[model samples]
Target: MRSFINKKVQTIKPSGIRKFFDIASEMEDVISLGVGEPDFDTPWHIRDEGIYALQKGQTFYTSNAGLMELRKAITETLSAKYDLNYSPEKEVLVTVGGSEAIDLALRATLDPGDEVIFTEPSYVSYLPCIQLADGVPVAIPLKEENEFRLTAEELRAAITPKSKVLILSFPNNPTGAIMLKEDLEAIAEIVLEHDLMVITDEIYAELTYYDEAKHFSIAALPGMLERTVYINGFSKAYAMTGWRLGYCCGPEEIMREMIKIHQFAIMAAPTTSQYAGITALRNGDADVEAMRESYNQRRRFLMHELERIGLPCFEPFGAFYVFPNISEFGLSSEEFAMQLIQSQKVAVVPGTAFGESGEGFIRISYAYSIQELKVAFQRLELFVEELRARKQV
Candidate 1:
């Protein structure tokens, strides 16, 4: 059986994010903040749409590219939000999730040994997905001092002639870092100079804390619409994770190839989910705003409480997470996370689980309730006090 496994697949490790929580699951009164899932239920209107579709007996398949109306809805949302334009007929693809869209984009665009540059500590899937697609993974270590935004210099330094695509995720997962327009403009210049392509993951777009600008997509930058693949979904914004629907837009030539792979592999996204998605995009603004406001309140509370406990976390303004520096305790990221869970009954992910660059940090999700967070922090503060006393000894 070991011999039957593909060599590339064999090299992959199990997700470090799930490891601590799986143990915590069996324990009583454990507060697990390891998973990044939103606490919100699927917005009532979206759920209603799904139920209505089922009631109408819409259980059949959509086209391989997904429902045309859903694709059109996606395009309209992108245009209204970020000034991006795409032909729903040719450039848009509906996928099972933002995750599936990511896989399809990689498979369609990468050739064997082509290099794909992405930053770490990023979402865990990027490296494994690149390898599964036979693309070389070139990981650039993003700096905490730089707030984890991928700098033009860092990107430029990593590129070689073999580089084919760059994966950018902002309002970033794990770190919650965001790139401003000026930051992206610098990166865009480097990308154009090298003739590189990008797969920008903007699943956290609507959750940004900015009042005036909102989330800015790299694809909206001048001359970038044709060179970038934009991936977004209903999961993060509308709490539609189990609905399992996401969409991608890119150059029609690339999307045509992606559709072929999706056709052979997935056929179509769930017809019911697509119907719900159309409702989500069109009429879910107020629901999203209410959710975003709640998340923002949680985010600020977590930051303040973590600081009160002396954890020294960088302020994260985008996603619902805080990556606090835990190095002074002299424990490795894994050791810190494990011992904390074992001793205090609170579980958070080791930053090193994201990549080597995440050493000396730990990711705590704020998506859980304020009551949960308050209790969890009290335990964490006690754990920190014990560590300090041990250091004195």
Candidate 2:
């Protein structure tokens, strides 16, 4: 009992985002733009479907891979929206959430000391999951000049003989950047050249703001279907976060491996949630469209207000967040976020929490209501003006 802790368990740091959230919670009059969650409740029809499932006494586990009906719905949705065809029987796996899907994929594929390449300022889980799987986490920093899109050159530079996987998250988190087809083509060339497996998180695929830029999956590209694992869910699109249901589709061999991990660890996702997810895929297209339009409006409003208040932010094309440069305040990102929350009662995540490249920025989510956004902006304006008057800007 003197010293029995596992080295891997002791090495992981607490999540920086959660630490700030805990502090922000203790503050009074705070308007949080921090969390990366959709503000909308799950659409009524989907909720009704879940309730109906419960009433029908369908609470038992269906199968480890999830209900065949839900998998079929997922396959259809993927084909209709992303032009990706995954066989429902052999190539799709329903998971507890995108988080669990990611964990299962990593566990299924990685061996100790294998290297996994991922971009910086990404969703926080990638590195930790890789480390927990005893894989090396190689982070490639995405530049602000490139709109935080991972470049082919950067990816190629990161790959080596030990590299086993690449994790790509687009309609990205924290920065709200999206990769276009050309950009994806360039990346696909590198992946093919290196013969590396890819796990792409497209959770925000439907939240794209620019009508001209459609979301394209790497798996949909030539020669990539066999090498890429596509992960997505109903959480962001249908505002079904609490449902905790997501799915992964890939080559049958890869999917079969991931299914083993999911089966052993999770057994099956919630049956009622699977029912609601089927409804979301089958009949909730209008709900997704409405939410996307609303988020686009909020995205534009936040960008305009942030720029008007003299914060220089990269214009985001997808997702529900804005990453604004805050370096002029002459404070580290953490300092600025803490000061802003303490002085202005507005909560935003420090960019440094995402990665080192995010040091001069802070991420503010645009998922709040219009009125709340306006109020938050007003407070931000006042706070900035006060800082500038005291020569802080």
Candidate 3:
């Protein structure tokens, strides 16, 4: 029976982030700053649209690529916001989530044993998706000194004849690192030089905190449109995680391939969510602004409190997490997270959950309310003090 299971699936490790989360779930009074889920509910207008869809009996399957209207909205939104253009009919695909878009992209592009270059401390799905697609996962370690941004030199060093695609998530999870326009320009040159394709996850683009450092897409750069798959979704920005709707736009050839996989595998995205997504793209800007502003306030407060508590963290300008150095206490990242939860009843994910490069840190999410953050930090202070005192002993 064991031999009948796909050995490749067996070889894959369960998500490290979920390891502690599962333990924390069984415990009482645990304040979780672990998962990257938004604390905000889906905006009222978006929810109303979904309800309206249901009332109108719009519960049937949409087109394999999704409703033409939703695809048009996605293309228009991308063009208006990021100067990106795609044909609604040929170049866009709606997926179950940004997660599914990633899986489809890998499956569509990767041949057996083709190497996929991706930075470490990235979203958990990347390596696994590559592996499941029968592609080789080549990890390039991102340095804390560089604020975990993938450098051109690092990318160039990772590429070889076998390299086919680069999986990038900016306004990154775990690290909350963002690649600015110039940073992307440098990487684009390398991709062009290497003739590599890219699947960029920009789901957190709307959560950027620094007004001066707005998010930019690699696909928008020169010579990149033909070689990049741009993935974004309603989940993070619109707080529609449960809706599980995301879209990808790329060259027609690539999109056509991805759509084939999505058609057979997922058939179509949810009808209600697609309707809600139309509303989201058209009328959810103000709601996004409010949520982003709230996250920014929490971000600043967490940064200040982490610094005051003597945890040196890289200032993350995007997303809703802070990755803080926790090496002074002489514990592995997993051990530190485990002990923190056991003794302090506070839960944060270990940095190693992202990659080996994250060994000296832990990711604390700031998506919680200011009051919840205050309580969590108070517990963190006491926990750190005890660790220090134990070290002295």
Candidate 4:
């Protein structure tokens, strides 16, 4: 019998984050800070909307582009939140989550051997998605001293004549780093100079804390709207991860191409999810505000506790995760995470799961309840103390 795995598929390793999560699952009394999900249940009002849609027997598939109402809601939200305007009919494509949006964007735009430039310590999907699309991924490592932010110089250095797209995720995953307007302005200059297409994932746009820095969309910058594909979803802000609904907005030409792929692959986003997403957009502002405030509180608490435990973490400006330097522990990120889980029953993802630049750090999510966070922090403190007593730190 012949082996059947594709050569490309065989080259990809399974997600490092998921590997640890599987290990953590079998351990007794484990308190996980590993997953990057909101702990809140989907708000009752949104649930009622889904239920009402079901009760009305409205289970048919929506249009390939999703419901016009939901698309319009997204258009208005984009204008209100980011000052970027997009047409609901021609410029928006609903997807099965930001994950699908990402896949569609890369597939529609890339040809084999095309280069996609993105920063390291980002969401894990970018490299694999690029590879799946037969695009080459060029990773620009962000510096720890710069708080894991991607600088314009780094962006400029990463681009080559083969560069087809630049993938940017801010309010970043695992690192909680966000780019300020000035930083984005500098990057916008580089993008224009290189004539690069930009795919920006701003799923955590509403979760910004610390500085009052508003989210800057590359599409909103000069000469960018025509070349930028903006991706966002209700998962982080609306606490609707299970809804599996997200959308992409961009120039009509690119959006139409993305829609062609989506229509063929997915048909449309979930009908019930589209309906509930409308409610999430129309009346979920208060819920988003409340959730953001709670997350900010937890973020501050986690930063303080990590520092108190001798883990010097950069102050995160967005997202619900903190990446703390654990180099003092004299263990690799994976080893530290493994020992922490085994000894203290506390689960956190090794920062190296994000990228090579994250090797000396560990990512702890603060999306849990305050009490649960306190318990985890206490365990972590003890674990660090024990390591120090053993001459590990």
Off by over 4 Å in 1: none
Per-residue error (Å), model 2, residue 336: 0.6
RMSD of each: 0.8, 1.3, 0.8, 1.2
Encode model 3's per-residue lDDT on 175-226: one tens digit a residue. Answer: 9999999999999999999899999999999999877867899999999999
Which tens-of-lDDT digit does each residue in 300-384 have in candidate 2? 9998898899999989998899999989988899998888888999999998788787898999998889999999999899988
Overall local distance difference test of candidate 1: 0.93
TM-score (C-alpha) between model 3 and the true structure: 0.99
Worst 10-residue lDDT window, candidate 3: 207-216
Per-residue C-alpha lDDT of model 4 across residues 1-393, encoded as one tens digit per residue: 226878887888788889888988998888999988999999999999999999999899999999999999999999998889999989998899999999999999999999999888878898899999999999998988998888877887888999989999998998999888888899989888888999999999999985666777777888888899999998999999999999999999988999999988889999999999999999999999999999999998988888777889889899999999999978999999999999999999998888888899999998899999999999999998998899943
Off by over 4 Å in 3: none
lDDT of each: 0.93, 0.91, 0.93, 0.91
Tell me how many clashing residue pairs each candidate has: 0, 0, 0, 0
All candidates: TM-score: 0.99, 0.98, 0.99, 0.98
Name every residue pair that clashes in candidate 1.
none
Off by over 4 Å in 4: none
